[model samples]
Target: MKKEFAVIGLGRFGGSICRALSTEGMQVLAIDKDEEKVNEFKNIASHAVILDSTDEVSLKEIGISNFEHVIVAIGENIQASILTTVILSELGVQRITVKAQNDYHEKILNKIGAHQIVHPERDMGRRIAHNLISNNILDYLELSDEHSIVEVKAGRKMKGKTLIDLDIRANYGCNVVAIKQGKSINVSPMADEILKEDDVLIVIGADIDISRFEKNLVIDD
Candidate 1:
């Protein structure tokens, strides 16, 4: 089954989403008030339209409600973004993800019923900072203010060590949810399995515990 998605506002963020979704073979409707932005995505998305998202009649005409997921990525125009979200919420869009410009904008988006709010610039900065701080960290996902899920690559200290020998759970209080070796992933890695070189461990736990784990095991002595 092909999943359907709609993205409103075709700036850098929305354009990226449009390309990524289309690349995955999903049906996407790209909408933007800017004609040039819409035209740019015509070949990339399933459908691209130039329309005012703030207008309720225009949104309904495009059948925006039919999409299971809709992203409000309107840039600069905070008023238009809010109005569009209100209409989407009233129309009962299943999932609404909005890009927030600031703290005040995020608060309004939350009150208007956005399912997910993304702070792109802030998030990217955090991710880069984490990668710079821990050389072995391949990826970092913030689950909450206090917790994160990180993909930590096996370093010299972790090579040939089993889960039990490392005592990851008891010592650092983090759980290895999966182990990735090349393209194959083991969701249920055994306790006695020896970690090989270049193995990526997907671990989830509190931020403090993850930091401790990195300090003790990931970095070189």
Candidate 2:
């Protein structure tokens, strides 16, 4: 069965999501206040509508609550985004994902019952900054404000040590979730799995613990 989704606001973020969901064979309803934006996605999405999302009456008339998931992607208008999210929550939409422009916006969205809040731009910036700051740190993802998942290149000190020998969970307060070598990855690696130089380790734990682990495991280059 195809999952139904409604994307509110046809800006770059919303439009891209609609196209991607449509490409994955989902039923996507794209909405926007601009007729041109709506028309632009006419052939891409299952349906496109031009309406003011802040207006609860208009939303109800269009049956916005019928969709399985609704995305509030209004970028410039924070008020509209918050109102739309509130309305969607009141209408009992199964899931509501909102694009937050900043920390303040994210707090508001969370308070209004948004299921997920995305800081796409901020996240991307953080990733880029991490890569720039440390050559060995391949990637970083924030699981929460405190926890994180990071991919770092295995150092010389780590080579030839099995998972049991390293005792990551016991010593570092983190787990080696995966090992990526060149073109291959071992997910949920066994306790006996050995670490090799140049291999990338995907570790998950609290941000402070992960940072400590990285500092101790990864050699500065």
lDDT (Cα, 0-100) at 195 in candidate 1: 97
Pairs of colliding residues, candidate 1: none
- Give a tens-digit lDDT track for model 2, residues 1-221: 99999999888899899999999999999999999999999999999999999999999999988999999899889988999999999999999999999999999888989999998898889788778767788999988889989888877768899889889899889988889988999999889978888889999999888877877776464
Off by more than 4 A, model 1 = none
Per-residue CA lDDT of candidate 1, range 3-39, in tens? 8999999999999999999999999999998899999
Tell me the TM-score of model 2: 0.90
Global local distance difference test of model 1: 0.93
Best by lDDT: 1
lDDT of each: 0.93, 0.90
Candidate 1 global TM-score: 0.94
Candidate 2 — number of clashing residue pairs?
Answer: 0
